[model samples]
Target: MNKTDLLKSIIERLEIDLDMIQRAAQTAYETATAEENIAENKYDTLSLEASYLATGQARRMEEIRQACKAYQQLTMRDYDPERGIQISNLVQLEDAQGNQQLLFLGPEAAGLQIGTGPSKVTVITPRSPLGQQLLGKFEGDEITLVLGNGRQVQEVVSAW
Candidate 1:
């Protein structure tokens, strides 16, 4: 689906904070618009040199719009944990170092220490490298994670 469709799906499935998204989008839009206005001399801000910056600022505003559209689309996906590896699933895993890390893949704000409620679940987005490696891996699976200096280790602890 397109970005708007994806956003709708995300809103339906995940426990996201809508206010945060709205605030960020608005702030970005406003900042971009203000910069554009200043650059174009639409408002009393700077010298003629300011207009040159407006074009770049306008482009930034479009970038923000595109990002919003993309993020909106993302909110509209199936968040089933008991299915194929996806952003909505909580993947409790340990790398080869035996260090267990809990990942909760939700909207940006949802990444913070979320609760363990009925609708709440840890998440790991499939787009991430670690998340990609965990896909299709079942319990008791052994894997390696590459870290600094090309060092790799086998994950032993498989507890969730």
Candidate 2:
């Protein structure tokens, strides 16, 4: 799949997630303030606990909303492979065994994967270990990744 197709999929997924989060957040907020959750005495903390849970849910919902907004507002730029890797670039990497993975670097939405088959794209941020290592690497460059006690080598096949 092309970048446009992958980007559309990502936005669609984010919208779905945002809707679900809003619904869940509303439910949690309502449940927390419901009469059944009211504290009966000084020792009663059920309502307080529910309120805390609701707050956390609301916070998470806000975070997801922000992420969706950031993604939607991203300007698609034409990237030159020779310019090296950067956010908004589609990169192709190959391992020693010839296994390949397509990655889309973005400012947000890290760990979000889109597409299937050979067109599958995994979203990564610069803060991630692999993303950090891939930054500034040109095509045909080999990068050594350290994972715990093992090391794996991957080559930058292409970037667009």
Candidate 3:
């Protein structure tokens, strides 16, 4: 398939995850608020107090809102090699060392890399080590990573 077809397929598949994330976020917000209001349920205090644990409950809501926004941004995206390297971006990079990978970032750890059949691409998330390496890079610029074998690999290859 062409780039347009590939991108369209990605966008279509991403909607399923985006919808689930949005629902989960919305549920968390409502549950938090409702538990805060439930004066009769003493055990429900945990939910009411969860925000204190994760920092600000209000901030959590804001974060979920932002996540939904990011999902929306991703769902509408067409493959653009010029978007620059960063989180939530599907980037391709090549370092002086020579490791290559394709990225498809979601709100969390979720995805698969299908080779051959239809979409022959290496799937990875922004949370992975490789993802972290390619998080902020430009074409031709080098990115290197150390291995458990005491060897450093500086290989990174990117496609749009």
Give the top-scoring candidate (TM-score): 2
| Worst 10-residue lDDT window, candidate 3 | 106-115
Q: Rank the candidates by lDDT, best first.
A: 2, 3, 1
Per-model CA lDDT versus the true structure = 0.47, 0.84, 0.52
Off by over 4 Å in 2: 41-45
User: Model 1 segments beyond 4 Å from truth?
Assistant: 1-17, 24-89, 95-97, 104-122, 154-160
Q: What residue pairs clash in candidate 2, if any at all?
A: none
Candidate 2 lDDT by residue in tens digits, 18-100:
79878877877887898987888999887787678778888878877887888888876656666688877899999999999
TM-score quality measure for candidate 2 = 0.89
What TM-score, computed on C-alpha atoms, does each candidate reach? 0.43, 0.89, 0.42
Model 2, global lDDT: 0.84
Per-residue error for 48 in candidate 2, Å, reads: 2.9
Q: After superposition, how far is residue 12 of candidate 1 from its true place, in Å?
A: 11
